[model samples]
Target: MQIKANNPDEYIAQIPEDRIPYFKKLRQTILDNIPKGFEEQMSYGMIGYVVPKSLYPDGYHCDTNLPLPFTNIASQKNFIALYHSGIYASPEILDWFVAEYPKHCKRKLDMGKSCIRFKKAEEIPFDLIAELMQKLTVKNWIKIYEQTIKK
Candidate 1:
């Protein structure tokens, strides 16, 4: 579905009727576990929660303004996507997710970076997903971000 959200609120409102429930649940999951020093906004036509440059001015890649640690949630044509930089930055977290939630094997997890896709709401491991979300909050993300910046 097409999302015409120019801002975060509009983005949340623009979610297609069919995908509203899933989107809402996912949105709430992220909001409920939001970390400190992070700002929520709309980026790449999706709902993105980011760690501002002030906290890590050089957080982005290639000197870009994009924040190093963030999560992006989007409503795709056939599925919903939840993107988190945390997974790619923390092997321990990613490994635990893959090991504890093999049921998600059918789901598309873009480990290449940090995007995880689910074709349906039922496909998502809500509890596990929330756990990861909490672990990846701005505070924890900074620690990982620092390690990454050094390398």
Candidate 2:
């Protein structure tokens, strides 16, 4: 579940031992695909990727001192959650993910506007996840974020 931790390593360490490698693989995939200018940290009791304040001084609209959140991966009680702001902000990307998900995954995509939930590690559509991670850069996300706030 939402085990609060002081940092990313601590947050990851809180994962169930048996599930460590599974989460690690997901984490590594995100790391490999994440564009430059994003930083990884512990945010909202989960592992988060964000656009640092150094690059965007306005920071997150919710809290000006905090970075703009891009995505997050969390180990939950019944499932693991992957949250991506890009998919939530862009209908085209969301549609693309929905249409392509079945091609790569056997399970139904348990999802919300931004959060994709996986009941088991095998249920994760990693290729799609990686592709989505790669698609959103800091500059692109900032543009989307600004548009969203305006709306």
Q: Give the TM-score comparing model 1 with the true structure, all chains together.
A: 0.80
User: How well does candidate 2 match the true structure in TM-score terms?
Assistant: 0.95
For model 2, what is the C-alpha lDDT against the true structure? 0.88
Residue 39 miss distance in model 1 (angstroms): 1.6
Q: Which model scores highest in TM-score? A: 2
Any residue pairs clashing in model 1, and if so which?
none
Candidate 2 residue pairs in backbone clash: none
Q: Which parts of model 1 have CA positions greater than 4 angstroms off? A: 103-112, 149-151
- 1-151 in candidate 2: lDDT tens per residue? 6698988778778888867877888999999999999999988778999999899999988888888899999999888899999889998889989999999998888999899998888667778888989887899999999998633
